[model samples]
Target: MEYKWIALSNTTIGVLMAAINGTIIIISLPAIFRGIDINPLTSFQYLLWILMGYNIVTATLLVSFGRLSDIYGRVRLYNLGFLIFTIGSILLFLTPNTGDLGAIELISFRIVQGIGGAFLFANSAAIITDAFPAKERGKALGINQIAALAGSLIGLILGGILSVYYWRYVFLVSVPVGIFGTAWSYLKLKELGLRSKGEGIDWAGNTAFGLGLILLLIGVTYGLMPYGSSQTGWTDPYVMASMISGAALLVSFVFIERKVKYPMFRLELFKNRMFAAGNIASLLRSFAYGGLMIMIVIFLQGIWLPLHGYSYSETPFWAGVYTIPLMLGFVAMGPISGWLSDKYGSRFLATLGMVIVGIGFLLLTTLPYNFNYTEFALMLFFMGLGNGMFASPNTASIMNSVPAKYRGTASGMRSTLQNAGQTASIALFFTIVILSLESSLPTALATAVTNAGAPQLVPLVHNVPVTGALFAAFLGYDPVKALLANVPSNLIPATAIHIMEQRTWFPTAIAPAFMGALRNAFYIGGIMTFIAAIASALRGKRVIAEEKEEKEVIKNA
Candidate 1:
């Protein structure tokens, strides 16, 4: 009934909705492609767009939305976000085309949803900080962050279940929640946060920053796609041009911010030790873990589950089911860590969390492709606990360091870095995997075909596109089947044909190569998280802004 509780509950719903949509499409992609009558193997561009578009838009817009909320009103923008997001969901659910058109429509609608998500993400933390007292912010933020993580995990399972009956249900499920949230937010949420009364929007800075980030993220997304002879497009002229131009624009944005009267980005905020270190640590942690869930899901769907006798159709649901331990660990530790941080400083708990997460990544490398379920589950749970411990305390430290009038801008900057880091992580990690596969997968495929008494078909299947193979793994399709679709029956014996056709053969053959590539990713992730731990340690001590202000006033008096 209290205003703070009201703010917390509404923002939690907004965050949960935004986070759920972020991941819901991933597990449901196979079914979505089927529903739209599109062949995923031949539609890699559509797949990439569908997967990355929402994140790209959300990441690009958060800072601007945050700045705007500071000038206008946080609650007003947040309510608009809820309404826009609901509209996007409705459009996606009622998609009226098929094939390429359908995929394009879906991508367009998702971008709309991303716009709304940016608004919600940019303001939620600021709203929460404004509503709660300084000492209680950690607990409030912890619950909020927990909703984000839980929503992502819940989206995976929910998508898997709903997609079984109809793909449209995936989008449909968000509609009622969105409608209710929109109405509730508009009616009950108040403009309680301080606002900058007359700061004009810095259009020049906003343009440069938004366009720059858009170009950079788009370049990264395409960089994961195949370009001519290369397995990845990092060297393509267009990709290079986009990235270079994007970098130039971002540099210009920095200068523009320096000269502007009312800049969108609050660069001066970085001078604060707590704010700087907390944000840097948050970005590194996000970079380290963003693609991790997807990678694990791929391992389960493409290899482990299939080799263990689960059908391709069943892999999606089971993959979601098996990851529950990670969620459980997060739920258990989130509140406890928040409460602890409120009593002590965030420095110790936050640093310890990154250390634990780093260790979990390293321990993951020890598992073989056919790792025992118990070991795998425990490792996942361990990583989840580390994330739960870090998220809230770190967020609380960052929000509490800034002045009240700038909380919206600060929150936006934080969300932007976090989202951008995640988007880049997925692109970078996927590229790493694809490059690894390029060198090793062809030989492995050739050898597997020869051993299966299909030497005649070796050359045909050997040079399969690495991107296609990776997509197959993500989509739960058998790459070998698609590769051998055109082969004459007479060219291969019946027994060999049957052997290659079994659901287990390709998974068995690819596991060794895939695991090797995956281990490389894990090693890099471990190193990144460890560096994040160092950053977290560098946050020094927690300083509450209001308390410091009060002390300054007393001394002056």
Candidate 2:
């Protein structure tokens, strides 16, 4: 294969591996917690950490890593990323301890993997942009992006299948792929992108940005946990302090960057309308996309699958299977839209894609709790199609608009915003769902328990943390069974116990309330996507002449 093809294939593999690791843990979390002997209900903080830690790390480090790639070489850092990722995978698979220690080890190892992911995410687009001509950049990035997204969907399937046998296998699956990718990247990929030499590292800027983001994300993470009498820690002094301090640091970082001779991020790049608009749209789209997928999984596993006769144990796998059409839609449209973008420019296609995605979200809000599979699948496919249409062209516009030397930093900044959006989306969406559930779930649970002839258990069920219930359903466990596990069997009649444990019963009871909260989330997501579409529409046509002019200015300077 030619060098460009080599670069594309290797980076695609790297991104796929990283992306797969990202979501594979979601479906496998139940098995992982079980294997580690951690109760999902009581150890919700650990669950939250496991879910959000990798994203937080990647989001905070992308810009710094991207700038480093510019100073060193994209290929060099990318190769190192593959190696580090492989090592992290091996460590995760070889976890020896059980319980709290094991969970901590896993989370820590995943952070290592995230560091590797940051390197790959920061550099992959820059490498591809360097290899492909401007006209063909969209198509190449489309294929790479498709791999990344398809990997996420594929992870759900793989996690379902692998975790059925052994949770270790979920981490194990990545080992061989990572090894191959690392070696291939080292041997086949070359530094085709321009590198900046003699530019000093902006330690002050990097410190401020990284610390600020870290504090902010940490606050968001803790905000989901209960604090004292409150259902959430948003009012906790530590959380409030973290958010306030983090915001202050970020503001200071921006000022510091403006004054520094060598800044970690090139703030000037946002001056270009295409770059700014593309990044803004990318951020909003990611926020919507990330939260949407989580809600869809909860919808399927918590309500739809059980109503359709699938057991809780089987829901995770079947949910993955049912979602395949969505991935297929993305695969089908991604390359074609990318090629078209090369001809017509990204503004229209990307904006249209966002609009289509908004429509899909709106359609989801109209779904009844027991939605038809065909209709649900169609809506998912449309959303996927829209995302497919938007991702590549927007990425191309961002990369193509920047000068070659700054591509690494630009790519980093883009990934940082996108990843930050995704990380924040989880917290934002979960908080919304949990808050909604808090207001209504207690009354709903009490009514259901009383109706089921288990009125004695109403108080217990009413006090269940909304987050715990959501997590139980998300992990494909029967919430009723979990709640009833502590109740004395003698107090409830046999028939009542049976009814409470029935696959359909709990889902039916919780459906109305869950759907209400979920619909609210969908509406929020839809509104965000609509806003993103507007941003996308506002981006001007790509100007090749402007890029040439900027390149000349850089060379002269």
**How many residue pairs clash in each candidate at the backbone level?**
0, 0
* Candidate 2, pairs of clashing residues: none
Local accuracy of candidate 1 as per-residue lDDT tens digits, 15-86: 999999988898999999999999988888899999999999999999999999999999999999999999
Candidate 2 overall Cα lDDT vs. reference? Answer: 0.91
Alpha-carbon RMSD of each model? 0.9, 1.7
Q: What is the C-alpha local distance difference test score of each model?
A: 0.92, 0.91
Best by lDDT: 1
Tens-place lDDT digits, model 2, residues 1-557 = 77889999999999999999999999999999999998877888789889999999999999999999999999899899999989999999999999889989999999999999999999999999999988988999999999998999999999999999999999999999999999888888999878999999999999999999999999999999988867788999999999999999999999999999999989998898999999999999988878777878888899899998998989888888899888988998899989999888999999999999999989999999998888988988998899999999999989988888898999999999999999899888989899999989989889998998889987897778888888888998888778878877999999888888888898898999999999899899999999999999999978553468768899999
Which residues of candidate 2, in runs, are more than 4 Å off?
545-547, 550-557
Model 1: lDDT equals 0.92
Candidate 2 Cα deviation (angstroms), residue 86: 0.7
